[model samples]
Target: MTLQIDGLTKRFGGQAVVDGLSIDIAEAEFFAIVGASGCGKSTLLRLIAGLETADAGSIRLHGEPVSGPGLHVPPEGRGFGVVFQSYALWPHLDVRGNVAFPIETAGASRNDAARAADRHLATVALQPFATRRPAELSGGQRQRVALARCLAQGARTILMDEPLANLDPHLRGAMERELLAFHAASGATTLYITHDQREAMAVADRMAVMSAGRFLQVGTPQEIYERPASEEIARFIGQGVVLPVEIAQGTALIAGQRVFLRVLNGAETGPRSAMLRPSDITATDPGAEGAVAGRTLSVLYRGGLWEALVAVEGLAEPLPVHLNRPARAGEAIGLRLTGGWLLPEAAMAAKAPRRAAASAP
Candidate 1:
């Protein structure tokens, strides 16, 4: 392993924000850690970078202990490049100076640092703006400068904390491409933290879903999206909505109607819940056999597709469905289920108390 974190723990205000968190990242791997806000993802990154000390556990890089009992390496000494959400560029310095500062600070001559910075800037396609200061550059340009600076430092491990969060949506795609290219060229072990699941899925070779300071599941983006470990993970990742149903002979009874679909995970015949993505559902002809009936509550235009909220009888929550054809509110629609991930009875029951408590006034 290139990076190993064991039994890591961090607390704030007497509460365990990062409780016993641990992860292993291989060398030259692009790994993303994704979760909602205040899930201790950023704090975990800070702990790994040595910006903040770990209350317990240890961090190892290349089999060398960096944070542990009586041994804490300074952030600068850890040889890890960090890209922050704010870009963190030097205001007074031009692009080249901002990129070269880290190198020069690490005992390199000014000329050598400038030469190395130029090469890195060209790699990021920012060589033309070398003489411009951070104030003169656009948000995306400044981000590239920050990335170039990290590359100039020659760190094999790159840590980014929502680096594209500050950029406009249109500019995020370009930066993501550059990041992928940079990783391919440098082969750095990157640990990226983001609340955006789409962004993480677009870039990471593997990602972990985190909640309340613990990883709920770790796997490829497809695996996590297709077969979430639990209902919370499915909802968090926007994979789909979990629907309560009765299963018997591999068929789920929805809205007093039996619909046949493949149920991922080892689910037996009983009362349970299953997560079905919007795409897995299709609108069929009225009164179609093996179809679950629902009324369209609303239809929303989502770029290339129309998204509709379906209200089915015998179900409390509305089902979200993405449609290729147009849909009208209050229209009768028959939903055909093609795929779903089943959650065992115990897991569904476990989530009931939490949901009840949350909805209580």
Candidate 2:
């Protein structure tokens, strides 16, 4: 299944929810849409699912136009299945019955539906609990059953809307892997939505970071991480800090000196903000190349990392540097700021309205 959104706009009372959103989703690829709540991420999914209407613009499923008042395709007719955050399984139905429901609705024989249900349940590793009702299943088990049912429904495309939201941290991680495995095995064109940066980065083949209703940036995980288009994109992706650093030509003005750093964008000279990733900052000897000395103000363990708050000269406040090597608090150390880019703040702010839209039901 492939999806194409061309100027797809959804509005409520004259406010655009999806704005002029255009995206092309390829068949057998996992595409993730990420955004904060109230940013219309879920509404976009609903629009694609035919659960809601777009006030303007177009949505194409395999290149067929979709929208308008009476000309509508319900969820079932869209050839898609959804795995919601709540699982949405019938409490009174057993696992087998729940998984077989869609097939039964399509007029499959009793034995055939049961056989298909059992097969799909096995795919999700939940066949052992076929007779168990949703009330008797664990959270992760119920989620797997939901996935089983989605697969059994013969959906060409799967829309997973934050399906891992209700799981615990450990379960979230486990389920993330399971979803990837399931997607890999099924080779279904999957579109997933999430607010979790790490989750989007970890699983998606490619993802679009959104804010207000607009896509901040769309690229591979590495492209979005190593070279973000703006400060907001950098911050949303959760990397090093973006500081207000002045730029001159190809060099940045810091510590009262023009220091050279990498520039992904060819902008030279003028006021700008440079993005510094946590892992990019390093502790080095005084004579080491590009070293900037600073006094450590604080130190904290970050998993396998050691983060320290250090005061570098020529900066108003202390700059937070992430060091892999352990450092003592209050220790005088030489710091180096390397591997970041100076970006225009205004460029990112301009993308907001083009992204946000009206509310969805």
Candidate 3:
């Protein structure tokens, strides 16, 4: 393992922000931790970077202990690079100086440090801005400079905490691509923290969904999207509706219609909760067999296609569907559910009482 954390915990004001988390990251892998605000994702990153001490447990890099019982290594001694949302560049220094400062501090001559800085700047395609001050560069360009500095430091691992959160939507997309290229060029293990699930899915080799100081689930992006471990995870990772379903003989019964059910983690025959994504349901002819009748409750045009929420009989929440044409409010439509994932029995049990109370009146 390139990075290993075991039973790590951190607390503030008698509240545990990070609670007994453990994960192993392979060399040169891009691992992402995603969660809502105050879920302790950032604090986890800080612990790994040595910015904050662990109240309990151990942190290791390449079989060496960096943080543990009665042992704490400073951030500068960890040989790991950290990039924050603020970029953390020096205001008085130009781009080249910012990248070369770490090398100079490590006992490199000025000429050697400048040459190494230029090489890393070229790697991020920021050589043109080498003479510009941090304040003079755009947000995206400054982020690239930070990445270049990481490369110049010869860091074997990098920790990023919402590094692109300050950028506009359009620029964020562009910088995401730049980050992938930087990771490939540097060949360093990366631990990224983000609130945006979309960004995490786009860049991660594998991701963990965190909540309330613990990891709910960890897997590839597709696995997390297709086979969420709980109702909360399904609702948080993407746009979806979880409906009560009855399963028998490998099929699901929802709204008086039989649909194919992909059993992910539960018994094949029983009452369960089914998570239905937009891709699982499709518009069909109203009179088609096995099609459920519904009313369009709302619609929004999303670029080339239309998105709608459909209210089906016997279901509590409206199901989201993608349409090739416009749909109006209160219009009648037929939907065929081709596929869905069944939630495990534990998740259903955990949520049943709250749902029963909510629907009581």
Top model by TM-score, which number? 3
Ranking by lDDT: 3, 1, 2
User: For residue 333, what is the lDDT in candidate 1?
Assistant: 90
TM-scores for every candidate against the unseen true structure: 0.91, 0.87, 0.93
How would you encode candidate 2's per-residue C-alpha lDDT over 1-361 as one tens digit per residue? 3777767778877888787787777787787888888888999999989899877677778767665445667776788889899999999999999999999999999889999999998888887899999999988999999888888888878999998899899888888889888887777888899999889888888888987776877777777888777777877787466777767667876665455666755656667777776665667775556678788889999888887888776676676787777888778888766556665457554653442221110
Report residue 314 deviation for candidate 3 (angstroms): 1.0
Residue-by-residue lDDT tens digits, candidate 1, 1-361: 7888888989998898888877778888888999999999999999999999988989998889999988899998899999999998989999999999988988999999999999999888899999998999988889889889989888889999999999899999888888898888777889999999999988988888888998877788888888776778888897477887778866786676566656654436877777878877888866898788889999999899898999988788888898888989999999887766775445553453221010100
For every candidate, C-alpha RMSD to the true structure in Å: 5.9, 4.4, 6.3
TM-score winner between 2 and 3, please give it.
Answer: 3
Q: Count the backbone clashes (under 3 Å) in each candidate.
A: 0, 11, 0
In model 3, the worst 10-residue window by lDDT is 352-361
C-alpha lDDT values of all predictions: 0.84, 0.79, 0.88
Candidate 3 lDDT by residue in tens digits, 25-94: 8888888899999999999999999999999989989879999999999988898989999999999999
